[model samples]
Target: MPRPAEAALLSTSLIPTDNSTYEALPLVDSESLQALITHEALNASALELFAIANASVKEYGHPTRVIGSGGHYKTLGWIEKQLKNMSDYYTYEKQEFKALNGMVFNHSLSVNGVKVLDEKPFQLTPAAHVYWADLVVIDNLGCEDIDYAPLNASLSTNTVALIKRGECPFGNKSSLAGKWGASAALIYDPESDEIITGTLGTPTNTTVGTLGISKTLAESLIAQKNAGVPLKINMFIAAYVGFIKTKNIIATTIHGDQDNIVALGAHSDSVEAGPGINDDGSGTISLLNVAAQLTNFKINNAVRFAWWAAEEEGLLGSNFYAYNLTALENSKIRLFMDYDMMASPNFEYQVYNGSNELNPPGSEELKQLYIDYYESKGLPWVLIPFDGRSDYVGFIETGIPAGGIAAGAEGKNSQNGEVLDKCYHALCDDVTNLNWDAFLTNTQLIAHSVATYANSLEGFPLREPPKVASSADVPYKFNLHGNFYIM
Candidate 1:
């Protein structure tokens, strides 16, 4: 990392002067921007900017930032609360958190529509493991899983073996059944009527779809067969994992027009991979710097600075905010600007190519604004696709004009690529992974855009206000998924 004094001096010296081509406002002064990034570097380590973050988790067991886990949300909440306490000029709104609880497996067993087993929330089978088959009780008791001899060649093709959960692990039983050509395996609790959930632990060459049924259900099926009553049963299983309680920290200036808002966002949560300091801490810190500095001046249009949650999980936080907005609320958003990886170690300034076909109206003009700013500063920049891969996806899909910048990620790390960010999403993506020079320059660009739009949206387009659906019209209550990589 660069020395704080040097970084501050270098940052301050590059503050762009007002040009005749575009009218600029001093919403954030040069001195404050320098101080903010300097403060940023000084406080980096204390921020716990690394993977296996929580000492408590490490002391107790392995440290991993699993989505919706205690360590993950707790760290994020603390950071947002600290930022919330930083200023009084901006009003804060913490979006309600949502978490993706364990999957609710819906399954059933029906004998010619007699409904032998009713559909209910069951345990999650392994992902991509779905099946329907006739039940076959291999009452081998202590040796059902190990003794495949009980399941002979005469068994039906749709066979689903029923075994007691005792002698061996769940994976062993499922493996045995799968080897015998059984379509699925039903593992039941030996002592109670309660259904038990189990995992296959890891991938295996032959692992069948597995479910847990109660002792009562297993016995009843056994009795029917003992009574010489021929039974034909059906089974169904499915699983989904998403939407946990995570928040978006939104702080808007109280001095500007709420009707014409200039929104700036950076995702707060990091991936399960690492603390994501350069991948996003750089962007988050940049926004915080600008937000803190902007308190010194007022604006004509509202500047809403947002630190979105669950961005690592597919832009869910931003998507939830945009999806729930009414038409009037959508129209109030003049534009949205996103800041993702602005300080990649091996960096290249990437401006979103809003001139492309993916984005809605007004994106090209926003793209041009960035192009002009970089050109005026004599900086080298390249255009990246506007492919709805970032938080801007939600805003653009809803007709809110959006633009932003990025410093390359994993995909842009090769000889043929414009730039290479080798530390993209790994544990190495810490504070040291950021190039301070690129960090300061991109942050200044963000400050310029924020100030320009907050002061006035003079050159931007004016079209019919956005048409957002009513609350009842949206199919899902929230949009949640995770896997969009940094550009």
Candidate 2:
């Protein structure tokens, strides 16, 4: 018996482009270090530093080399050797702060060492007496039992508060805390065990100081407060404020005679944690592969691929590029596709149809396109509610057609009766943990969909006049089943 074609998939070569200038844009060379940054080992500052240093050295007349070879691409010593190899072109330097800054410390203390200001289960001493802190520490303050009106009043004079972890949600707590007059808030762990960190939603209203600390440190601070000991702790934090310049690397290929454009994008910036391979490296690589495969195909409408920067800092890069477009350019845009996290082993695939309230112009057609492509390939998929969680937010906000696929993220996965990919936004999200089979399949689907849309003669496959629907007219009703929802 012979092996099936899908079982023995062969890599295809990208079609050569006549436009040499656009071809010059780097397109996922295996040697590129962008993939390595997905490991969560490198923080955003380090990634930025690496990009700046690499660009500077390249311009300084050093041998044109791929920057991804350092770190995981090679052995530690080999990585050092590569850096040394480029030493002639650039100098590596680290700056130290005069004050304890850019550093976070975790500490724990015995229960005997701490004092209880209040016998009540949750109440703690006021922030004024705690540490003369720019902010006060109030751990585990949630909305359920605890009333925040008093705390909010107390915080107005102090301007800062640190809440211990657990109980209520962070966003709700942050919202309540903001009402109480806090400039910033830190949520530390109660167990005093491992470091606790997670996403703090968009800081739209108030500038609330947010930080994660270990349970050990929280307990230690509590103990000190109880003992009436004047506790002195040190922490170093660094943030750069003001306008920073970044670029949106755009690579496009036009096939057919259509005037409309279909855009696919993935942000390249990693958070201040590790290389963001799963965070977005997976999406970036998938799109890059799609681009490489499309190079050979001639299509009608333009297919534009982009690797955006500064996405970690509030979608700055993508927003800037999308909004900065001229009237002519905006009109030419047909649909925007975003691939943020398209590969998580534990969760099923989903398509984000921008806002259920309104079809949002081109979303319904794009959703059908994804569904049809998945069906053609005999794959199972689900449609998820529209979320402005990625670069797609910009396009949707501007009334441009937008849709994309997400494998699984940090949320729970009801279909498989499993937790959502736990490694999301963590240092554990490396390639070793990915389900490559799913990755490959999803990547292929993305490429096929883009190619079909670009080749179709009906410039934009989506309906031009937006469809209006009332709650009674809506065809699908979602039923919540355990952790998963059935549509």
Candidate 3:
């Protein structure tokens, strides 16, 4: 990695004073970044959950609740408590922490529908009359101690598997379950509003299931079993099956009355391991702060904010959200700004220019946005090829303009003027490992571009999509699945 002092000096020295286009744009403040980091560090529920599981806080003499015992609980209440603590610590007034009833299935096990195979231990078999097998009730299972071997074996034929939702990695378990054969997986928590979906890894040869249930559902099923009552479940897996219910949380602020919209987004869900602070919490929090700060600011176009879920699972969330939009909605979307990993401590930042040769839909304008920000702030940035690794993939493939920023990640070598942040997705990605100044600067740049695009009288100046070259004209053709275009 570049020396901090050198990076700072180089960044400051590169300011472009001659540029009159964006001279008056506001820069991100270090204090804001510090405040965000502090808040994220203290309040991020994901991080706190991991800390409790790993017993990290136990060493500090304040042990967190366990997964299943009397004092052990995982509820939205606990999450709210943590959020409140952080808000109080940071003095954030009017802070509202809400855990929405995100999604529901058509078949969630209920006491009146399932036939108990073994009444003593409570084993169940579905009734023939039930059309939709939405819920699966398992006899004895804990998210932590459940034997996946049986579940894996059963997945080959089972559309859904009922499992407890504590102590296990939902993403990995869900992937394994999917690999075996299940169409969807449900993990109910004995305690909280932590309704987690299973993380799907890379696309598989066979498309089986699409969604995962929360721990709360599992607890409900267990209660039904204990009561010796059959459970009835109504399951509505989103039409985009094998990947159902994945969603992108989108919010928009119109600059003026412009029809064109500049979309800025980041995937909100993290890998099941940690709260994904650096992997995405950094980006999510940054975007939130920027949006909050820019809420009243004047803009000419529309600035949209989206927090995507299930991105860690093969970009399913964003893909579903983007593809499901109506034709009118698609036409209104002018540009896509994606921020995936934006605060890695190991590497210098990079801006992805849609493609190397021709600019992608909104590549040029996005590039100019970053360039203006860096030049005005005297920061050094490099433009690279779009790898289609994040939520922007759907937009770019649909020919919508797309560009994004990235911090470092694991396996990204510190080569070609890039430095690697080794702690990319590990638990070590705490605030201490981050360069707050860089984070703040990058956040400001993102916010500024969003604001600029919104305020510009001309809608996002989109370049035509690159022409599809014939196979003969193509130098090399890799057997890739999606469309690859130049920016």
User: Candidates' TM-scores?
Assistant: 0.61, 0.60, 0.51
- lDDT tens digits, residues 249-340, model 1? 77776667888888999877665445567767777777877776676665778889888876665566787777666787788888889999
Local lDDT at 373 for model 2 = 71
* lDDT by residue for model 2 (1-487), tens: 1212222112222443455543443332221322332323223322333333233232322211111212212222222233333332212221111110011122121123343221111101111122233334553454432555445445236444557655544545555666666654555656434455543323335434355555666666667667776543222233312232334455555343435777888766444344455666667666655654454444556777766655654565566566555555666777888887766768577887654346356677778777877787687888876645678755665557778888877556767666456665554555544666667666766766676666662634442432222334422222211101100
Count backbone clashes in candidate 3. Answer: 38
**Backbone collisions counted per model:** 11, 38, 38
Over 4 Å off in model 1, which ranges?
1-52, 55-66, 101-243, 356-358, 413-419, 469-487
Candidate 3 lDDT score at position 218: 53
Q: lDDT per residue, candidate 3, 332-389, as tens digits?
A: 7777888877667655668776642443545666776777667776767777556655
Flag regions of model 2 displaced more than 4 Å.
Answer: 1-148, 152-184, 188-208, 213-243, 355-357, 457-487
Model 3 residue 69 distance off true place after TM-score fit, in angstroms: 18
Full candidate order by lDDT, most accurate first: 1, 2, 3
Q: What's the lDDT for residue 408 in model 3?
A: 62
Q: CA lDDT of 361 in candidate 1? A: 66
**CA lDDT, candidate 3, residue 344:** 70
Best by TM-score: 1
For lDDT, candidate 1 versus 2, the one ahead is: 1
